[model samples]
Each structure stands twice: as structure tokens, then as C-alpha cells.
Target: MNLDTPIEYLKGVGQQKAELLKKELGVYTFNDLLQHFPFRYVDRTRFYKIREVSADMPSVQVIGRVLSKEIIGEKQSRRLVAQLKDDTGVLELVWFQGIRWADKLVQPGAVFIVFGKPTEFNGRFSISHPELELYNPSAVKQGNLTLQPVYNSTEKLKQSFLDTKSLQRLQASALEIVGRSIQETIPDYLRSKHRLLNKADAIQQIHFPQNPNSLEAARHRLKFEELFFIQLKLLRNKLLRTGKFRGLLFGQVGEKFNAFYSDKLPFDLTNAQKKVLKEIRQDTQKGIQMNRLLQGDVGSGKTVVALMSMLLAIDNGFQTCMMAPTEILAKQHYASLEKMMGQGFINMALLCGSTPKKERRIIHQALQDGSLNILVGTHALIEDEVQFKNLGLAVIDEQHRFGVEQRAKLWRKNSVPPHVLVMTATPIPRTLAMTLYGDLDISVINELPAGRKPIKTIHLFESQRLRMFGFMRQEIAKGRQVYIVYPLIKESEKLDLLYLEAGIEAISREFPLPQYRISIVHGKLKAADKDFEMQRFVKGETQIMVATTVIEVGVNVPNASVMIIENAERFGLSQLHQLRGRVGRGAEQSYCVLMSGNKLSREARIRLQTMVKTNDGFEISETDLQLRGPGNIEGTQQSGVLDLKLADLAHDQHILQEARDAVIRIFEDDPELNTDKNVLLKEYFLRKTPAISWNKIS
Candidate 1:
């Protein structure tokens, strides 16, 4: 059978087993089965004695003879228990689910080899459902048990008799069909230059390695292949877009930009900000659409850069639109920009779900008449009824929150799509950015604005609430506000309200309402009510704001000097970093108090320590990447950019770099993969094209 043969047609995997393979592992064809590489390999060369086995050990192998076998318990709970003895001690082997099947393979006097995890219960050691194989002296003499590959299997698959061992057997049978038949996908010259293993040998060694060195080589080759293809795909799209789409040229920075930069500038732009602005100017100057991703730490003046870019568009007689994910953030941006612009000739408007009908009519008239130079709003900006007259640039804040289709809708607003500048406060790790946003040009605002004091982070236990409250009082006495953020309890809103009530009560008892005006906000509150509470805090009507993570994204309170994160351990490092960012926006010295429980996990401790140590968002991001893999990062898994099987973004940075460089060389030499050397590459890419272009979404 060929590689394209259905898996059910294979030797060991019949229709029933094939369904299990497809359902559990997503393996459909013979080739798909072959590519399902083992997660780990075990050495069967050495056998451990029963006395040497421990609870902390991974799966271990031991040569033993079954001393006694018994069927214990009644129906439904019935199990087959066998007492196995090596040289030193006796070990109990129990099978809970497959007692009938296991009772056949193992017997009282049979000499067998057992492999499984060991656990101690009630002062006795037992191995539940150990893999037992008949022991043959000649098999050890022939070195047949040197290495064993273990495939991941689901419990359902195991119930259907397709366990890990069954999967391995099926894989071996599929490999036999694929033996020496696999053709090299990469060009021979590139393989030679990179010292990569051939596709056939790599596949074989990956599944059943003859030696550890071969296994490592196979891993390197496979990882390189996976990353190389991803880079190639992203780079190819970038090239195609640049070649095909001509951007509306903002020829020069004119009146509006010059006026904003020279006359109405709020603060001097940091060098980091200046550099990013320069890069953006260069992109807009070129006659190509700019799909640039601007990454910066919270409070790194990203909104300022965005404003300057919008002004650039306005200077060239075109309108700009900024879309935020939420109405609160949209209003915040509109307010901040309005305050910054300060009654200029340039007109700006805010369009959100809550915008008054009169204001919406005015915005629509101004937009249609080309009088509105800039519009900032939420998803309402992309509504069919709201259209732009001369939309030249679109700036998306927290770009990950929008889907590809939503962004595409914005692109269609203009015949030639406007220059798209997507900004994020969450600092993406360099490697992750390369894979996730490789198609988009990236600019990082790495420095905080000058004169901004680094927020001092402190970790305190629940017992230290009194001290935290005292510190809050001191900060409030300085005429500054404090934000107390609580984690959301999704299990029950009643329980959540109880937690919020308890916190509010404690704060009221400590800093009473008449003495301290405290506002409460959460997701449970209605939109208008939430806004009312938030406005009170922002307007400085309240001395303290007790809220949930709803305030994490776009709340800007310059007067707020302290952020007290209750149960900080429940928050991710990135979330903690974002909450910490809320307070340090002002020029005054700020503090972030991370209150957690007495007991902390190793990861939790690292997160707290990292927060307390530095204010670098990139550093915090890297630590976060390590602590909670790429999948758990905000919106990344949903983006499908990190849908990797084997090559880990956390650990394979070097491989990724190498693969990216290789892609660059390939494109530089042959942009269209038209050469004979790259025909295989083109075919492979065509065969594996994803159903959705995930990168375009972000």
C-alpha cells in the first residue's frame, strides 16, 4: 500500500481500530499515522529489582515471575491481582478495567517483564495495569528490548483495546508499508548544506531509533522542517501582499502632524517612540500597505505613537479610524486624545454602542462630508451604517481581540485598504512574535516615558492586609487614589458577589465610606452602571475603586497611585503585569501590592518574585512564556499561530531562527518556488495549506 492508503487498510488497524486512531490521534492515512511521532522513548536494556522501585520514579522495567494470581472483588469492581517477585522483593500487579483480558496473558508461574508506574497505598506497593510481556532469554540475548517507543492514547481508545502498546504496534505495521519509500521533501542541496537527515531515515529514526544520537538528529531534522514550513508560509504571504497591494501614499508630514508635534505635544517623545514613528513614516512613505504590529509595554506611549500616525494621515487630507475592543477603552482613548488635541481645527469623534443618536448622526455627516479627520470607537466603527469618506489609516488597539473577518471588513471600507497599524500593550516574546506576526512588520516601544517612576511591586500574604491597608491610607493621604482588583469567580456569581462584598466590607471597616468614597465595578454590573462607577473613580470622586479584572485593559487613572491585587496568585504573570501598569501611568511614585495566600506553588512564587524584581514587560513576558507555555498566552491559541505539535516555541528558539533564515535564503533565491529545486517544496506547501489563514486574523 502507498502512503495515501486509508489507515483501515493497514495490517494491524482494521475498521474499528482505524476509527479509534482517527478519533483519538487525528490519523487518517498511512502517512498521517507515520507522522504521529512518539512523545517519549524508554530504554528497555536495564531491568530494576522490586526493591529499587519507588513512588517518585517514572515508568520502570522489571523482570519478574508471577508468584500468585487471584480475581478479587465482586462484579463491576472485579480486578485481577497478581503477586510478582524479582530477586529482592514481591510487587503486586493489579488490573482494574481489563481484568478478563489481562487474566489471559499473566499466570501464576509465568516469567514476564513488567513495566508501569509504581504507587504506594496502605504501606504496600502496587503497579496498576502494568504492561506485561512474556520473558524469553533469547530475546534479551538478541538485544530486542533496547528501546521502546510510547505513543499517547486516550482513555476511550484504551477501552476499545487500542492503547499505547496497540498504537505502537499499528505504527510499526504502517512503517513497514512505508519502508524505504518516503521521498525527500526538502531539496538535496539544502539538506546537505544544513546537514539534515533524509526524510525517510528521519521518519524511521523518529519512531524507533536505533540509538540516542540518531534520535536527537531525527528530532532536529523534524523540528527544522516544521518551523521552516511555517516561516516559508508566512514569508510567502508577506511577499505576495507587498507585490500585489499598493497603499494610499501619505506623501509628506504636513500641517496637522507638524502642528501636533511642535505646538500641542503633551510630552517629549522617548527615543524608542521616535524610532518607531520613523519606521512607521518610512512604511507609509512607500507605496505599499503597511500591516505593522506595534508592541509595547503598558504605559509605553503606544497611544501617543498611534495619535502621531493618525495625524500623519490627517496631514495628507485623509481620515483615520482607531478601533478599540471595548467601549470603555474607546471612550478613554477619545477623552485622552481630546484632552491632548485641545480644541484644534482638526475634528475627531467617538462612535460606540452607547453613542447618542444625535452624536452618531453628526459623526456620520462629518465622516461622509470628509470633515472628520479622526474617529475612535469600538466594533461599532466597523458597522455597515458607519462609513468613512477618506479612510487612509486604521489603528487597532489590542489587535488580538478582533478576528480576521472583522479586520477584513475594515480593509474593504476603502478600495485600496488603509495602512493597518495594530497595537498591543502585551509585550510578545521575540520568538513568539516571529512565528505569530512574522508576516506583519514589527516595531517595539521598549522604553518607558522619561520621568516615569518604576512601580514598586510587593508580595504580601493575606495576614498582611492591615499593613497593606495602612500603606493605602498613606498613599491616599498624599491625595492619590487606590485600585483594588479581585479575580472573577466564573463558577457562581453569588459566590463572586460574596467575595466582592467581603472585600468591600473589610475596606469600609478599615477606611469607612464617609471617610473614603469607594466605588465597586465588575462584569456582573450593567454597562451604564459600570461606566458610572468607573467615571467616579476616573474623575477622582472616589478615593478607592474596588473592581474585578474588567479594569485590566483600558482604564487610565493618572491620580491612582496604588493597585492592590487580591489573590494575585490566581492571576497570570501577564495579567499581574497589566494590573501593575494601571498605577504607574502617573508621574508620582506608584506601588503594586500582590496579596496572595500563605501557600504558593513554585510557579506562583516565581511569578511574584519576577514581578517584584523588574518592570521590563519583555522580561516578564519571557518568564510568563516559561511558566505557562505559549498555548495559555492571551488569544494565541485561538489565533492558531501556536498550533504546533512537536516544535515548542519556548524551547526551540534557535531552531526557529535557523528555519527563518533558511526561508529568507530560499525566497531571495527564488521568490515563487519556480525552480526545479523547489518543486517539492511547492507541492508540499500546497498539500498542507491550512483551511484558514490564521495569521491574517491577527
Candidate 2:
């Protein structure tokens, strides 16, 4: 049978069985049937004598003859007790709610090989309902027994008579077909160099490992191939992007950059930002389409670096557009940029979704006629009707929020594709950054701006709420605003929203005087209402704003100095950091109070400790990567920046770098993967990309 052949077309698989297999195991094709690897294996080679069985051991197999068997207890909670004896000692076997089955399986004076964990009950050794196999005296002679493969199966499948044994039969059938049809993908030299196994051997060993060493070798080969092909794909995309798209050469606008650095700013820009800006300036002037990622901690002067890039664009006689995810953020950028550039020198317009028709018409006309040099907006900037005069630079904020298509849409705004600069306050672990943005050049603003004090982060239990309240009161009395954030958007049937609503009500009660204003915002509130509350907080009308994660992204209030996240254990590390970022925006010594619930897990404690020790987003992100792995760096939807299978963005960073280096070497030598050895790599990419249609060039 071919790889694509239906399972029913194979021998012994009937229509009913095939449908059941498809529903239960997702095994529709011969290939799918062959690739269902076992989750674990039992080393049947080691057998423990009945007398040698221990209570603490995970599992043991023992041979013994049944001495007695009896059913006990009521109908609802019936149990069977069987006393088994070997030459050395006796052991009790118990089964709950399966007395009839147990009675039939263990007949008195019958020898059986049983496997399970042994426990001490009433100072006697006992096994609770062990898996049994009938012993045969004729097959007694043996060395080490073969390991038994344990495939993952559901109870429903077992009830339908499609248990592990049934699945194994189907697997045996597919193995015969696969043995004939499948060809080896890895070449010999590289296999020998990496000390890897052949594809067929690897697949077989993965499903039914002969030993632990064999399993390790098999895993290494498979994982390496998976990562290698992914790297090859990304490198190819990078090559195509860099070679084909030409960028406007904004030669060393160091004069403009230095002017802002040397004189204009109130506080000195960090060395990291300056270094990244230099890199960006060099890339923009090289006449190659610069696709660079500017990663930084919150309030690290990324905005200033982005502003310098825009200035470079303007100095080179081209217009720039900085797009934020939200209208509030767009307005924030517009205001900030206006203040930085001082109005009319570079005509900036705000063309958001909420922009009035008349104003939008004016903005559209201004954009088309080259009157507008800078435009800040949401997705409204990428609308088909919104044309640009000369869009040389496109700076996207919070890059993870936009997908390849969304970014590509903006790229299409300019005929030649504007040099893209994606910015993120969310510090992605470096390894993840490589896999996620392998095609883009990365520049990290690793240092905070000068004189910016690190946010003092503290963790507290639920019982310390009163102490936290008192601390907040002191902070507010010192003329600082406080932010109390909750995890929920609205009340749910499953989750209690008592903490959220209670926090709001409690804060309102604390500040009962009319002079003190308290605002409440959450996902349940209307967008306008949320915005209004945020505006009040930003304008200093509200001394405190109790809200949810909806305000985590870009609801900036520089004056707000205290952030208290309730039940911080429920939120991820990166998220808590983002919430913490809401404070520490201004020069005041900001503080973050992480109120956690009882029963903190090891990982949870590590997360809290990481926050307490460091304010570096990059470091926090790295710690997060180590803790959670790279499962949701780009989020769940396909629209997120990075989505990968098998590759752990956090743990596999080193591998990613190695793979990237390998790709570079391959390209330097061959340019295209046309060599005989690289054919498998190409084929591997072809096989994997169909799911994402990543192979299709558009």
C-alpha cells in the first residue's frame, strides 16, 4: 500500500474497524498508522521473584501459583482477594469492582506471571489488581525478555474492541506496507557524522525501543531532522527576503541620530538603544530591505530608537508610518511623536478607525500628495483605500500581535515593500526569537534608559491584603496613582469573579472622599468606557484604576506608580511582567505587589522569585522560557508571529543557532539545496509545509 492509501484498503481492516480507528486515533492513511509512536515501553526483561517484591518499587513482575480466591464486600463496592504463593513466600492480590473478572482470571493452583506495584497492607505484601499473563511451562527457558511497547489508547476504544492489541495488529499490517514503500531520507555520511540511525530503524525504535540507548539515539535523529528542515525553510525565506527586496539607502543619518542623542533629550538614551540604532541605520543604508526586530524591556526608550529610525526615513525624503495595535496606543504614539518632533516640521496624521470621515478624507489626500510625512494608526493604516506618498519605513509596535499576512499587507502599501521595523516590549527569549523571527535581523535594547529606577517587586499571600492596602494608601498619599489588576474579564460559571469586583468595591470604599476618584475597567466594559477610564487615570483625575489584563498592553499612565496584581499565580510570568510594566513608566520608584494564593507550585514560586529579583524583561523572558518551554510565544491563533511543532523555542535555542549556522554553511557552499545529500532536507520541508502552506510562494 502507498503512504496515502486508505487504511481500509489494507488487509484485515474492515469498514467498521477503519471508522473506529479514524475516530479514535486519527489514523486515516497508511502513513498516519505507521507514525503513531508509543508513549512508553515496559522492560519485561527484568522479573522480580514474589519474595523480592518491594513496596516502594514502581512495578514488579512475579511468578506465583494461586492458593485461594474469594469475593468480598457488597454489590456496589465488591472486591476480590486472592492469595498467591511461590516457593519463597505468599502475597495477596486485590481487585476493586472487578471481583467476577478477578475470580475467573486467577483460578486456585494456577501459575501466572503478574505485573504491578506491590504495597504493604497489614504487614503483608500485596499487589492491587495486577495485569496477568498465563504462564506456560514449555516456554520457561529464557534470557532477557523483549520490552513491551505501550501505545496510548482510550477506554472508549477498548470498549469498542479496538484495544492496544487490536491497534498493534493494524500497526503490524502497516509495518509490512511501510517496509516495502518507504525510502530512507537521511544520507549515510551525515548519519555517520551525527551517529544517527536510519529513518526506518528510528521509526521502529521510537515505537518499540530495544533499549534506553536505542531510544535516545532514535529521539536525537528524529528531533534533529525536524529542527534541521525547519531551519532550512526559515533560512530560505531569509535569503529570498534579503536578496530580492531592495531598501531605501538612508546613509548614516548619524548626524540626525546624534543631534537627538547629544542635545535634544532630557535623559540620556541607554547604550543598548544607541547600539541597536546604529545597527538599524547601517541596515537601512545598505540598500537591502531591512527587516529588523527591536526587542526591549518596557520603558527602555524603544520609542526613542523607533523615532530615530523614522527621522532617518524623513531625512532621506521618505514618509514613515508607525502602527500600533490599539487606537489608544496610536493616539499615544501620535501625541508622543508630536511632542518629540515639535509639530509642523514633519507632518504627522492620526488616521485610525475612529477618525471622522472628513478628517480621514483630508488625511488620505495629504498621504497621497506627500503632505503627510508620518502617520500613526491601527489596522486602519493598512486599509486598501489608505495610500502612502512614499512609505519608506513601516514601524509596527507589539510585533507578536500582527501575523505575516497583516505585516505583508502593510508591506504591500509601498510598491517595493517598505523596510519593516517590528518593535516589541515583550522580551522573547533569544532562542525563540531565532525560530520565530529567523528571517528578520534582531536588535535588543537590553538596557533601560538612564536614571530609570528598577520596579521593586514583592510577593504576598492572600492574608496580607490588609498590609497591601495600607501600602497602597501610603503610595497614593505621596501623590502616586495605584493600579489593581485582576485576571478575569467577566464573572464566569466556572471561575469566581469575587476577587475582581471585591477589589474594586474595597478600593472605592477606602477612598470614600469625593476628592479621591477611583475608576474600574475590565474586558466586560465597553471599549469606549475602558478608554474613558484609562484617560481619566492618565489625566490624573483618577487616583486608582482597578482593572483586568485588558489594560496590560498599551494603557500607559506614567503617573501611576503602584501595581497590585491579585492572584498573580494564575497569570504567566511574561504577563505579570507586562502588568508590572504598567507602573515604573515614570521616574518615581514604582512598586509591584504580587498577591498569590496558597499552594504555590515550584514553578510558580520560581516565577514570583524571578519577578522579585530582576526588572530586565529579557532575563525574565529567558527564565519564563526555561520554565514553560516555547509553547505559546506567539500565542494560540495562527495569526501570531511564531508557531512551531517539536522545536522547544526556549530549550532548543542552541540547536536553533546550530541549525542556522548549518544553513548558512550549506547556502555558502551550494546556494540551493540541489546536492544529493541535501535532497532529504528538501523533501522533508515539502512534507511538513503542506499543513501551513508555507511552501507555497505568493
Q: Which tens-of-lDDT digit does each residue in 300-370 have in candidate 1?
A: 99999999999999888889999999988999999889988897657888899989999899999999999
Note each model's CA RMSD in angstroms. 3.4, 3.2
C-alpha lDDT of candidate 1 relative to the true structure: 0.88
List TM-scores for all candidates, in order.
Answer: 0.91, 0.91
lDDT comparing candidate 2 with the true structure? 0.80
TM-score of 2: 0.91
Number of backbone clashes in candidate 2: 0
Best by lDDT: 1
lDDT for each residue of candidate 2 in 1-698, tens digit (9 for 90 to 100): 58889988878777887887799889898888877766667777776777787888877788889999888888766889899888889989999966767787789989988887789977899989788877887886433365666677888778877777677777777777775666676667667866778988887777667778888787777766666666677778777777766777886564555666565665766789779978988888778899998888888888888888888888787889999988878888888877776756467899888899999999999999987888999999889999998899999999777666888899888877789899998898877777677777899887777767889999999888889989988988899999988887556688544467767777778778686888888877887888888888889998988888887877777789999998888889899998998888788899999998877889889999999998888888889888877765445245333444345566666566666687788878765667888877667667766653433332
